[model samples]
Target: MKLVRYRPAAGEAAMPGLIDGAGRLRDLSGHIPDLAGEALGRAAVERLAALDVESLPPVPGQARLAPPVAGTRNFIAVGLNYRDHARETGMAVPAEPVLFSKAAGALAGPYDDVVIPEGATQVDWELELAVVIGERVHRADEAEAARAVAGYCICNDVSERHWQMGGTGQWLKGKSAPTFGPLGPWLVTPDEVGDVSALAMSLTLNGEVMQQSSTAEMIFPPVFLISYISRFMTLEPGDVVTTGTPAGVGMAHGRYLRPGDAMRLDIEGLGHQRQVVR
Candidate 1:
């Protein structure tokens, strides 16, 4: 099932919904509070799957989408997890997962405008497969970590290279800008996503292809990353871990986003995202 959070209109409450077979949105608000915390767990998803989707009230007209999962407290990410991406930047493949955090406030709906922060010079993009944690776990084994996963979604790991590499060299400075983390058209449960390791993903800037690769290129897959992270910090429900981008970010080519530039990102089975720089 494809789960989503959205507002039917501006200033309205955000509600959870499911995308039925015919591509219509059906309200799931009566069934759950929101797609966060315990609602993200396997048991909750299983219960929701048993619902008769066709009977739910249909949401009319267009709605503004929020990130598929809400109340994300730890917006973590992996860096240099893709071999090709590592090679592109002339860096050696990491011996272990390189982790970082993007402030939860950076999260934005997939189609929301990506505001180029004032004085920003090297704004760039990183298309990544984002994993939403379903249950809290610490020091988990790979199998346990796998079970803790809620599902997957797309994440555009928007960056400001200057803030990331310059200044004091703190990655969070570059990565935590408002609207920097654009995620989800919807979240596809693991069963529906099939093999997570082989999905094709790509990003396009201004109608031109910029980044293209498969999840197969990842050095540390999702489950391992989750497990690795849990050893140090508790993985809470509704937290997101973006698995890192592939080769072809703007900085590598001396290109950067300017006002009005458009970006499109896609990960097979997880749907796509569109953003215009503003």
Candidate 2:
């Protein structure tokens, strides 16, 4: 089922629902408050699925979409997990995942505008598959890690090179700009996406295709990534794990985003995201 969080009008409170075939949204929160149940969002799906469709309320056409995962506790990212991206960035392929965190304030709707900071010139887009954890686990094994996953979504790992590599080594400086992280049109459950490594992904900037690669190219898969990270920090529900972007970022070509550039990205059945650099 396509799960989403949307506001029927501007300034209206966001609500969760399941996206129907006619493009109407079936309100899940009406019956399942807080989107919590036996398995969090999944339980809502099971209960909602048993209801009569004709009895459910229809959502407005003008509703504004919000990030699928609301109140993300920790938005963590893996760097250079894609071999080609590592090569383009002039970094060695890591034997283990290189992890970093983005401030939660950076989160925005998938279709939101990305405001390029003043005096910033090296803005780039990274289309990545983000994993949403379902349950809390510490030092989880690979098998347990697989079970801990809740869903998947599309993420644009927007970056500013000057702040990233020039001033300090902390990637958070370059990554934490407001509206830098655009996440999701939907948060797809794991059953919808079995075998995460076979998915295809791409990024188009202003109608130009700049990056195209497959999850098959990932140096470290999601299961191993979750397991590795859990050894160092406890994984909690709603904590996001952004897998890495493929090659062909603007920085690699010495090009950067300018006002009016639009970005479109997708990862197979997970969902798609579009953002304009303002």
Each prediction's Cα lDDT score? 0.95, 0.83
Which number leads on TM-score? Answer: 1
Per-candidate count of clashing residue pairs (backbone under 3 Å): 0, 0
Per-residue lDDT of 32 in model 1: 94
> Clashing pairs in model 2?
none
lDDT of 2 by residue, 58-111 (tens): 875877778876657788999999988988889999988999998878888889
Find the candidate with the highest lDDT and give its number: 1
Lowest summed-lDDT stretch of 10 residues in model 2? 33-42
Q: Write the per-residue lDDT of candidate 1 for residues 234-267, one digit (tens) a residue.
A: 9899999999999999989999999999999999
Please give the RMSD to the true structure for each candidate, in Å: 0.6, 1.9
Q: Using Cα atoms with residue i matched to residue i, what is each candidate's TM-score against the true structure?
A: 0.99, 0.93
